[model samples]
Target: MVKLSLCAIVKDEEACIGRCLDSVKEVVDEIVILDTGSRDRTVEIARDYGAQIEHYQWNDDFAAARNAALQYVTGDWVLVLDADEILHPEIVPQLQEAIASDRHLAINLVRQEIGAKQSPYSLVSRLFRPLPGIQFSRPYHALIDDSVTEFMAQQPDRWDIGYLSSVAIVHDGYRPEAIAARDKLSRIRKAMERYLSEHPDDAYTCSKLGALYVQNGEIEAGLKLLRKGLKQEKHLDRLLRYELHYHAGIALSKQQKVGKAKSHYEAAIALNILPALKIGAYNNLGNLYMQTGDLTGAIAAYERVWQIDPNLPIAHFNLGLALKEKGKLNEAIAAYHHAIELDPTYAEAYQNIAVILLKNGKVFESLDHFRKAIALYERRDSPAGSELRSTLKEMGFKI
Candidate 1:
């Protein structure tokens, strides 16, 4: 039997710690909770789950607290998780079998940080590992991949890393409500800015800070940092360099700089990083091409996205728009229907379809779809609903 230690560094996680523990209690042999001065009942909740608790003072450094919990891990392998994350209940036996087989010293499991049940993005990494010499580094957004790689290089016999695609950990820590409640983004930027002040040329640090700035609506400032980071050659983390380029391209696209955005997207795509990110770059590149009146280029880019994941409503809807612009109404309508099938409440798809119907003189069907689109938009209190309502009144429809 393989010993697996579930290690976590938590603060005030009263609302979510129990669910986090309950989800993994059956999977781990030992639970080690290191609290960094929680004013709530976070420690009490962990104690109910039979966790060995330790307390550490808040030092404003995440890596220091993480390393403290690591010292108490007695198992051969450590699975690090956050209080706002939950392991899929069904993946436990699979996890046990994988670790027992000892096929790899490190495992990359899917970490899905869900925005909603409908749209969840995934990140996979070496979250489950044997911490022989690897310790989380940096103060704010800490990382351990470099140290892990260095450790694995010396242990040639166990240099292999396994991937568990089925075992997903759902992280709810970065939800908008959660971030606003704690003013988390401001604090994150503070720590990241401090790190970059000392190591200005560090690609990964600049990339991360750039991304946060873009998220907070600082376009020019974020783009400058990302472009500068891309030119730097000091960091051994080539994979993160690709991520920075992707973000830089996004910032450019957001500012409607099509040519520059296309260049960076092309650069990131060429690196062939993760499949999802690869498709994302292509999708955004396609949108840029479409915006620049390159319908052929847009179609090709959207086709690539559909090839990777055919059910993405945004890709299908975009493909429909591009097809409609190219004078392929039948195919456009088909694509729109496909998009609607994937997501029933796709208001844009309904509105687009209704516009096409009106163009074709299908009055009754068009009115029906217009009503659906209006209902959806009105529920969200957006400008589209008002415009549609005004259009209907102009067309002599009863209010």
Candidate 2:
């Protein structure tokens, strides 16, 4: 039995601290929280869960706050989590077993971004032994990877890094609403820009900030940073390389440089990385193929996506589109049904199914699906609802 501690840095996280604490209370032997000037009941909530709370001055640097929290951890292993994240219950036993191993100095846990549509899963080095040499780095996206690498380099064969394939944490911070509430975009940009100023050639920061730039509609600047990141041959790790190429592909695609984007996507997909991590590149590549009228390529890419993660509704929906375009009506309908099965409220899938049903002369069945889709779309205030209503009217139906 190994002692596991939960360490976190929080400020004004009253709404989510209790949820975060509850998820790990049964698993961790100790709870250490570093409060960085919380003006709310964050400390009070944490105290209810028996968290050892310490006050620290608010600093813009996340790594500084994280490192400060680490000093208070007494347990042999630390499980780092954010206030907006909860440990998945199913991964607890596996996590315990991994941490108990004498050979593993650190364990990387897979995190599922709750509200993100693309690249929903990510790997985070959250579980590790609290060794003196192991500390966090980077200001915005703080991580212990650099320190862990440095420590491992000293005794390359003495310790091993472990990984859990199952999702360990469910993070809610990436949601659109959450991002808006936290003003995360501007805050992260400011921090990363400052960090990049100091370390211009940092590939990790380049990948992250470059992606942020692309998302903010600064495609040319984003491409410049992404290409700069690719040029850093020595500092590029497998994950960083994948991100650089993936983001470069996104930027290139936005510019309508389909050929370059396809090449970059191929490069990203070719990387010896986790198949789940390549989902975004594959999905985007599939879309590109669809744009170029390469239905076969599009179908293959989408099928690959669903095979990697069957639960992804978008993959099935995209596959349905490709199959529909390829004249495989039955297969298309089946794919649409899979998408609906994964996400019952998927209005677009229902609409597509209705279109296919009508094409096959199943008028009444098509109308039923159209009604469902229209009702769902109207509830979401989507313009598709009115468009669908008009389409039905033109077809001599009054629903």
State residue 389's C-alpha deviation in candidate 1, in Å: 2.2
Report lDDT per candidate: 0.81, 0.94
Worst 10 residues of 1 by lDDT: 115-124
Segments of candidate 2 deviating more than 4 angstroms: 394-396
Q: Write the per-residue lDDT of candidate 1 for residues 110-137, one digit (tens) a residue.
A: 6665553222445545355656688887
Cα RMSD (Å) between model 2 and the true structure? Answer: 1.4
Provide the clash count, candidate 2: 0
The parts of candidate 1 lying over 4 Å away from their true place are 89-94, 101-103, 116-122, 165-167, 233-235
Query: Number of clashes in model 1?
Result: 0
Best candidate, TM-score-wise? 2
Give the C-alpha lDDT of model 2: 0.94
Estimated TM-score per prediction?
0.87, 0.96
Q: All predictions: root-mean-square deviation over Cα? A: 3.0, 1.4
